[model samples]
Structure formats: structure tokens, C-alpha cells
Target: MEWLAPLAETGVARALIAAPTLYLLVNAAHIMGIGVLYGSILALDLRILGLNRSVPLHVIAGFLSRMAAAGAGLAILTGLCLFSVRPVEYAGNAAFLAKLALVAVGLAHALVLHRGIGWRRATTDGHASAALRLSALASIIIWTSAIVAGRWIGFL
Candidate 1:
């Protein structure tokens, strides 16, 4: 923390601390990105939970996955930018650390599902197994937890 603080304290940190309003604006942008990202992820996960059981799984996957990919991309880009502005503080933030871990898990799940046999079979059958359903439930839980953790980073 000491190492990083000094580096930032000399560079962009000065500009950032000087313009406190930028902090609020960037936070707002970060939130909007997260909302879009999580909203799309939840939509896809809920669809897999049979919320729209009648729709072909691949069609739903194909459509919503694209939405999620775009939103997730934006979220990640913004998140990285935000992190750069406060790396030292974030490194010491337990909630931020937890949020980062949750995001890693979520990304791994998305990648695995996108590439693996289960999702492929489920898509072809238009029916996912109970395990897949459980995974969808887990996604919702992890994502919700991540959002709460991210918000709590400021407080704790």
C-alpha cells in the first residue's frame, strides 16, 4: 500500500484528488456499467432457469449472451479504469477484493458455459439439466453478492 500510494500520490492521483467531482462522476459511470452488466447476466441466467422455457435455448443463449458480452465488456473496461485510479486503496479493501473474486468466478462460469458440452447439449436440446439450473441460480447469487460487496467497499 505504501509503495502504490506514493506512486499515485505523485501522478494521476494529484489530478484526481484535486478534482473530487471526477470521483463522483466516475463512480456513477461505474455503477451504470455494472447495472447493465449484471442486468444482462441475470436475464441470461433467469432464462436458463426456465423463465422462458418455451423459447429455444440456443436462440435465447445466442441473443442474451450477446447482450451480456457487450455489457460485461463495458463493465470490465470501466472497472479497470476505476481500479487504476485507486489501486492502493482497493488493494486494502476487503469488500473490493471479494467483489473481484466474485467477478472472476462469474467470468469463468460464462467462459466454461460458452465452451463446454453441457451448454452445447442443453442448447441443442433446448433443455438444460438440474445442474445447469443450479448453476444459473448460483450465478444470480454471486452477481448479487458482488454488487453488494462493491457498494460496501466505500464503507468498509
Candidate 2:
């Protein structure tokens, strides 16, 4: 906090403080993006876990993947702008650092491992695979952790 306070007194934070509404808008966009992404990811996970077997995993995964991808793109774009608001504050914050780490791991899982291995394995027979189940479990942990860390940033 001491270090962050000084960092926020710098040029970038000064600018953000001067234009608070801009920061708020950027944060709003980021939140919206995360909401959509989470919605899709959670739905797919729930389906994979057989929470809704009637929906057909393939269709649910397809739809959710599309929505998640779109939301992920929006999140990345908005996150950049939000970071500009107080780069030093974020860089110095423990909760922020944890959030970034979780996001990095989660995005990596989604883009590479999940898409290449987990998803393909699951969708090959138009049915869910064990990999999909494992992935869903991991995804939930990662996203939930990210959310908790992000929330802690405000309190801290």
C-alpha cells in the first residue's frame, strides 16, 4: 500500500485520477467482457459435468466457445485500457498480481490446451470426454480464483 500510494502519485495514476470517468468506463467494459466469458465457460463446464445432459454437450460447447471467444477478445482489449489507468498500482498490488497470474493460466488453458487437447478429445464423438470433465474442473478453479483476487484488490 505504501509503495502503491507513491506509484499512484505518478503520471499515469494522476491522469486517471484527473479523468476518473474514463477509468470507470474502461473497468465497466472489462467487467462486461468477463461476465460474458464466465457465462459461456460456466455453461460449458456445467454441461460437461452432466449437470444438464439433455442439452447436448457438442452444441452447448460450440455456442459457449463462440461466446467465450468473443468475450475474451473484449476482455483483453478493455483490460489494456484499464491498466493504463494505474499501471503502477496494479503492478504493485498483490491481489492484482494474483489475478493476472490466474488469468494468464486460464487463458492459456482455454486457447491452447483446452482447444487442442481437451476440447477436441471431448467433441470427437460428439460426446463429452473425461478430458472435458477435467478441464471444466480446472476452469472453474482458475476463474473463481481470478474473481476472488480481483475482488480483493478493491478491499486492499
Candidate 3:
């Protein structure tokens, strides 16, 4: 609580609070980042789940993964800026906590999947094994849940 007040009083937070236009733009950027992240991940997960088999998995996977990474980076960076504006309030929000947990799990899942041999095999062979497909399905669910929780934050 003590630290959160300081965070909300930081230069970035003070500037955003003073400039409504800047805050709005930052919010828009955050939304766009989430859209890109979810969209690319959805496409890649679907491809792994037997959709768009006509396209090569290696190519699609590589491109979509990069796009997802970029989007995640942008989303995270902007998300922190937004959070800094009302750190104490947001910290107490259940929806915000849920969203954070979901995102953490999603990132952990991605790291494990990407670092494991299955990802390499699927990318090289252009074929996703049953386990990989299951992981893809899990990825879809986890990311969707995270997005939903994020939306829920506004209502709460």
C-alpha cells in the first residue's frame, strides 16, 4: 500500500493523470496490443489444431509466434504504465489479480512449450503431434480466459 501510493505519484502516472489525451492514446495502444497478441496466438493455435492445413506449419508458426511476441511485449509495457496510474486500487481489484494470474500461467505455458523438444519437432516436421495439439488447445483456453478477465476488470 505504501509503495503503491508512491507508484501512483510517479512521474509517468502524474503525467498520464494530467493529460487525458495521452491516457486515452495509451489505452488504445494497450487494446491494440491485446488484439494483436490474441489474434496471432489464436491463428497459430488453430493451425496446430488442424485448421489451415494448406499452409505450412513451420512458416505460419514462426511468423505468428513473432507477431505474438511483439504484441505481448507492447501489451505488457503499456499495461504497466496504465497500472501505475492507480496502483493501489488496481492492486485490490479481484479481476486484475485474476488477469495477472492467467497471464502468468499463459506465459509459463508458452515458455515450456517453446523450450521443449515438441515445439522444435512440430516446427521442423510441419506436423503437430497429439500432445502438441492438446497444448495448443490449452493455450487457446488460457489466453481467452486472460482476455476475459482483463475485460472484467473495467466492470469491477
Say which prediction, candidate 2 or candidate 3, comes out ahead on TM-score.
3
**Tens digit per residue, CA lDDT, model 3, 30-50:** 999999999999999999999
TM-score of each: 0.84, 0.82, 0.98
Q: lDDT of all predictions, in order shown?
A: 0.79, 0.79, 0.94
- Stronger candidate by lDDT (1 vs 3): 3
Q: What residue pairs clash in candidate 1, if any at all?
A: none
Lowest summed lDDT window (length 10), candidate 3:
1-10
CA displacement after TM-score superposition, residue 16 of candidate 2 (Å): 5.0
Give the TM-score comparing model 2 with the true structure, all chains together. 0.82
Which stretches in model 2 have alpha-carbon errors above 4 Å? Answer: 1-18
User: Evaluated with lDDT, which candidate comes out highest?
Assistant: 3
User: How close is each model in CA RMSD to the real structure?
Assistant: 2.3, 3.4, 0.8
Cα lDDT of candidate 1 equals: 0.79
